[model samples]
Target: MVVEKNAPLQPCNTFGIAARAQTLVRVRSVDDLLAVLADPELAPAPKFVLGGGSNIILTGDVKPVVLKMEIKGLRLVEETPKAWIVEAGAGEVWHDAVAWTLAHGYPGLENLALIPGTVGASPVQNIGAYGVELQDRFESLDAIDLATGQSFSLDAAQCGFGYRDSVFKHAPSEAQDGSGLPRGMGLAGRAVITHVRFRLPKPWKPVLGYLDLERRRAEAGVEHPSAEQIFDWICDIRRAKLPDPAVVGNAGSFFKNPTVSPDQCADIIAREPKIVHYPMPDGSIKLAAGWLIDACGWKGKSIGKAGVYEKQALVLVNRGRGAESVTGGEVMTLAKAIQTSVYERFGIRLEPEPVVV
Candidate 1:
């Protein structure tokens, strides 16, 4: 186990906030992690599992020991008449994994192309794009409990997946939400996801319900689009709207699309008829968070070094670089301000999507 001290973190996080981890370990395999657990000096320390660093805000220097997951692999684990079961190492680049599946003739993850982060963090964030979400294709996952150094696996239901949320995203608690998950026993900071398996259905169907995908399909006049076609369209759409994390520091959409009841939607529609919203099958309405922020006139606006992306108000970007880089404080301050303005105007509280460390 190679232990690094005072490791630079700016390069690790997508937001480009300059920070450092006091101690870091690069875990490439289960044995590597077990070795750390057996080390008396490192065994009892509180740990933070880091993947591609695409969805986090570093508030300050991280004090907990950082276990940088770098486990790597991609393979077809099983093949049935109904579905193709594919497995990926937790640290495998997410987009690469998606493309790999497509190249190998598996088509289910095409709509999710170009999404940033690693496979392990996919389920942790329940990452989705276009009209598809990770939970929709999830099979199961392998993880190791940090406290016990024991391995475990969980299926979709055990993950307690919600919109951009999962058991790994929650803090340790015993509060059951009656969602069939041991929700009360949240796994936040307590386990490390090592691998993920995706169940891609056999008679593949493309999920094109999202407005953007629908518009693209029509614009291209694609009546019966293939998986690769959807993949190309999504990549183009995202690149046009979202700033690349490598070129411009950002954490993708900064807020989750807020869901509201029918009555609440009716009231909002009465006041803001131009609002962009969608009806979910569950009888709730999901409002476009970008429209709300833009409606509040925050597009391309800045607070300190943190600014809302001009092209997409839903994204928060770092306006400064190096020593002048946006502090996590600035980002949070701007996020709070946006939340306040949206609530004051719409009576809806916007929830941020990134994890603050």
Candidate 2:
């Protein structure tokens, strides 16, 4: 573990916010993590578990010890006639894990390709795209309590997953020194996830749940496609639609598609009549956040160094304004404006998908 003080975090986050961490630790193993936590020189501040630097916006200098999770391992544990259990280290890059499963002929994770982040953080947000979620095949996870340094396992249900949220984010509040802290941040439960395990389907049948995917697959003359074909189609669509984080600074979709009741959906549709919405089987309705933002004329709009990417409205791209730049603040301001406008226009508040500090 390499610990540094006053570390520059601009290169660490996807938004490229010019921020500083009071202390930053690059943890290579579980023991390294324990040693860093045991050190008294490190302040007892709230910790932030960083994976692949995707899905986060650094507002300013992060005060907590920035733990760079780097644990890595991948393996096939069990194989039956129908399915296989693939267990991966928490620090393994998510997309790599997905590809590895595919190469080994495992079926379930092919839908999730090119997603940026670690296997550990996937479950934290219940990351979903193209009609597949991490929780759908999640078997269990191993995490360490920040306070006790004790490790434990949590089953799928214990994760409290609900539409891009989990117990890790909404843990019960516990006492803090002065700040209003949560229990999960305290001794009893301030857990830092280390390793995660997943069960994948063998001979996987591709799920064509998303309309965009179905349309594209058909247009490509692909019918009754296998998992590999579906995965390739999704990759092509994502490549065409989203900006590569390596080339441009961005955390995938900035906001989640808002879910509304059937009656609310009807009202919005009645006004525009052409508004696009995906109806949930549960009778709820999902309104596209990108469409709403674009309707408000926010696409390609720039405020200072931060602006909505001309290619994708839902993605806020940093124009490489350095630490002294105001790009980070501007991006937040624009997101808030979009959220407010969409709420007023359709009575639906778009929630941010990336973790904001």
Candidate 3:
């Protein structure tokens, strides 16, 4: 494992923020990770596992040893009459992996196309789009324990999938005896996901429950759309709605769509009749975060070099370029302003989606 000191980080993250890693190691394979752990100089150091860097906001120069996961491989692990199992390395680009699966005739992952980040980070965030989530297609994943340097595997249940959350999002809690055994469910910084496997069911069926997909189907004049058609529609819709990170530096959605109880929804609706919301399967009301921000007059507004996207109020963008780029503090200030305004107006708190490092 080659360790580089003060490695440049701007190119790694989707936000294009300027930052540096104190010590960075590019993990091209599992052996490289093991080697790093075995080394006396690096073994005890706190580490950060970085994938595609799409879902993170670098607050400043990272102090932890950055394990830049660059492992790359994709293959069909198994095929049965009921399903097809495909595996990908941690570093495989999530969008490319979805497209690869579809190209190989695996249809279940088409709904998740164009999501940023890597396969390794998908489960951690429970990344979803359209009407499907990563949990719906996830089979299992392999990870190495950073603390113990031991590799392990887990299924969906063990991952503890939730809306935009998973075990990886929480810190490990203390055991009753304080022996470091995690209580309840939280993996967080304890593990590094090395690979992910997806289970695509046989006899593919399209998931077109989302409004945009339905509208696309209507516009195309097709009663039943193929997987490829749905894929194309999703890509087109996302491209039109969200800015390409390559052109404009920003994470896709800045905040989660806050959910409220039925009574809470009624109360909010009584106050603001035009508030946008959707009924979830669990009987909760999911509020549109963008609507809340826009209602607060944040759209197209700027604070220093951080600005709210004019097209979609849900996204926050960097108004500056390169060296003049928006700092993490500016982004957080804008985010906090929006959150406080939304909470004061709607009596609901908005949570950020990206991990701030």
Candidate 4:
């Protein structure tokens, strides 16, 4: 457990925000984490667990003791006739893990390829793209209780997965039993995910219902696409649609596509017939947030050093470089402005996807 003071965090986060971790510790293994907790001076302090830093915004210097997860490993834990169980360390790059699984002949994670962040952060947001979400492939995960230093595992149902939501996103309340466990459904700051296991079912099939993917399939003139082909197509599609964070410094989609009732969708459609919306399986409509922001004339617009991505209005970018990069305040300001505009125009509140710290 190596602890560094005033550690620079610009390189750690995908958004390239200039910030520092007041007290930072690199946790490469479960033993490192246990050591931190056993330390007399550091054990009592508040801590923040950081993964790939793709889904977070740093407002200022982080005050909590930063526990940067760097645990690394990937292995086939179990193999049965029905499915292959693959396990990944919390520190492994998410896209690389997905590619590794594909390269090793496991095929279910193809649709989730090219997504930013680490494997540990996937279930936290129920990260999804195209026709599949993390919940669709998740088997179970091992996490440690920050309060008690006791470890536990959870299956998919125990995760309480909703659209881009899970128990990990909520803060624990004061309704704990004698065991210091949360009574209701919250884990927010009390758990540190260590490893994630994915169950890739046998007899793989390509998930290609998304319009872009369908077009790719039609263009290629292939009725039955292989998992590798779908993976390549998704990569190409994402490359065309989203600016690489290495070049444009962004946190993928800035907002979650808001869901509305059928009546609400009908009302909005009456006012704006060209609104982009999709009918979900549960009788709800998912509006395209990019379309809403673009409709409000916000694309290619900037508020200070923070700007809306020109190619995708749903993304927020940092226009400045290095130390002069956009501050978290600037990013939030632009996000709020967009949210207010969208809400006033469509009567729907847009929710941001990234965690604001």
- Where does model 2 exceed 4 Å of error? 43-45, 173-189, 321-326
Which residue pairs clash within candidate 4?
A: none
Which runs in model 3 stand beyond 4 Å of their true positions?
176-183
Better of 2 and 4 by lDDT: 4
lDDT of 4 at 102: 92
Top TM-score hit: 4
> How well does candidate 1 match the true structure in TM-score terms?
0.96
What is the overall TM-score of model 4 with all chains considered together?
A: 0.98
What is the per-residue lDDT of model 3 for residues 1-357, given as tens digits with 9 covering 90 to 100? 678999999888888889999999999899999999998988899999899888888889999999999889999999999999999999999999989988989889989989989988999999998889999999999988887777888899989999999999999876623433365688888889999999999889999878888899998999988888898999999999888989999988999999999999999999999999999999999999999999999999999998999999999998889999888889899999999999999999999998899
What's the candidate order when arranged by decreasing TM-score? 4, 3, 1, 2
Question: TM-score per candidate, in order?
Answer: 0.96, 0.92, 0.97, 0.98
lDDT at 283, model 3: 99
Over 4 Å off, model 4: 177-179
Q: How many clashing pairs does model 1 include?
A: 3
Candidate 1 lDDT, 212-331, residue by residue in tens = 888988998989999999999899999999999988899999999999999999999999999999899899999999999999999999999999999999999999988889999999
For residue 60, what is the lDDT in candidate 3?
98
